[model samples]
Target: MEHNHDNIKLTSAEVSYLWNTYLGDSLSICVFKYFLEHVEDKEIKTITTHALDLSQQHIETIQSIFLNEGIQIPQGFTEQDVNLKSKRLFTDVFYLKYIKNMTKGGLATYGRLLQNIYRHDIRSFFSKCLTSTIELDTEVVRLLLEKGIAACPPTIPYPQKIEFVHKQSFFLEGLGRRDALTGAEVANLHSNIETNQLGTSLAIAFSQVAQSNKVRKFILRGNDIASKHIKVFSSYLEMNSLPVPMSFDQEVTESTESPFSDKLMLFHFGLMIYAGIGNYGVAISESRKSDLVVDYTRLTAEILKLSEDFANIIVANEWLEQPPLSANRKDLTKG
Candidate 1:
């Protein structure tokens, strides 16, 4: 099972991972290129360079795999998708935290990928991806701590002794006010808050530079959505006397000049929306209380709608790329 049998062709799952990874990395390249152009802090620049290098390498490797398999490459973002001459959109501090969030997400993505990826070479590729991303994550975290900007999760007092939940009301319904949050629940809440905080910053930045009216309005609405979600998530932590994660809206600049094409910006928003939806799904399972589950499910549905709107905008511009699809059985039968 460890060695890849060359005779074995790739399953749909394997192809899906590679195809999706290719698109994500390609988008990262465009964003990082714009970051590097205006990034001032030496420490932030160092990690940004490393991140850009990693994305470039990933694109090359994925290209090699697709060519070898006779699969057509996805038309992901390219140089034309970015405009280097545009003014800076984000601050140096934003760049540092952005990498931290990115690698954190990358670890989750590449780790989950290993479960479905069976080919030895493909598995090995993602394994290496996990390792490299961990290294980047460490570097970003260390820098954040050194700068004293680390938003460490709230610390709860240790229980004197292990106790079992004996009450049925532990799964609170309307408000989780009855019982204190579990460790897993707190982690999910803080993580989601942080993600929304970052997303709000992105929404503000994107809305400032987006050329199209539709794209601008979508991202502006996204800012309101993220801010609203942040407040909801924060209230839970507040009720528990845990400090809520801080927002990064100030980290964005006032520049209105577009650094990325409208297509790229919209695509990035879609990616963020999808990730938010995925996080909500995970939070639903991690949460023990019914109210928390209901909240996540409701929020996920709202974000899913936002994702659909982004898809529509992308499609309207003819900028959406098709993923690998199975054969049309109806067409085959018609012939």
Candidate 2:
């Protein structure tokens, strides 16, 4: 006989993943709904609708799990956070690419979460998440290729034979590294450049529409940071004569009307900052060349500073939500 899921309490991993998933999907729902309002291409709209449905369904499932466990349902983003009537701030191409980029993040998160999760129910849910995100990612890639907007990575010559590194210089660089970038390094650099492009576009769009001066300034600073990071990463690819991805800045419209609340905008930036940090962390660990590691480390510090500023702004606005925590033994014993 199968043990009842309710009879077993959720472990820290389970609770944290569920809570984090709720937050991410809630944010996605707002962003996707806003995208759906402005998306005009038929095929793009269909995929956007599918993405939105997945987020909504995920939110409902999480809510049900939390309520059944007697845990408080997080007041994730809602209608109040979005304005469907607001003017379009991005082009149809931007909408499609945005969904594509976001699904990549979703796949990574769900896949990693599955590694630590052991509960049957939670595992099944995240397993479903992994599968659905894979579907979304595959669909978006096909459309991107079909519509000729993929900005696909450069092709390298076929390997003639297996090889091994024999020199210690492969890992050492006193002034500047002279070794050609490995395929892994090239992949990480290319992916980072693409991510920063998306970041730059988002910063520009958010800066234009944010109501508060502080929020606008923060996002504009983020734009500069993302742009600088893109250039730094792209130079490595260019030095190797590899093609760089195209910019999405032109896809953002000139509209200054805010389609999302300041709270939601700040919260979204926080998510982006953390996600960027995680990406850089992965790049750093996977990297073998000394300079690439140093550069990634330096830029990661910059992003860390940006995350600090985000914390200050979000806290000042009182928009940050507290996640579930261990019981306060000290509080229980007090007075």
Clashes of each: 0, 0
**Candidate that would win on TM-score:** 2
* Candidate No. with top lDDT: 2
lDDT against true structure, model 1: 0.89
lDDT (Cα atoms) of all candidates against the true structure: 0.89, 0.90
Candidate 1 at residue 98, lDDT?
91
User: Alpha-carbon error at 275 in model 2, in Å?
Assistant: 0.6
| Model 2: per-residue Cα lDDT over 1-335, one tens digit each | 57588679999889988998898899899999999887889999999999999999999999999999998888889999999999999999999888888997998898888999988888889999999999999999999999999977776677899998777678886644565887888888988898899989988899889999999999999889999999999998998999999999999999999999999888888888898999999999888889989999999999999999999998888888898788999999999
Prediction 1 TM-score vs. true = 0.96
Question: Which ranges of candidate 1 are over 4 A from the true structure?
Answer: 1-6, 173-177
- Candidate 1: clashing pairs of residues: none
- Expressed as tens digits, the lDDT of each residue in 1-335 for candidate 1 is 46745588888999999999999999999999999999999999999999999999999999998898888999898999999888988999999989889998998899887999888888888998999999999999999999999887889988899899776678864533564888889999999999998889998998888888999999998888888888888888998899987777899999999999988888888888988988898899888888778878888888988888888888888888888889989999994
TM-score on alpha carbons, each prediction = 0.96, 0.97
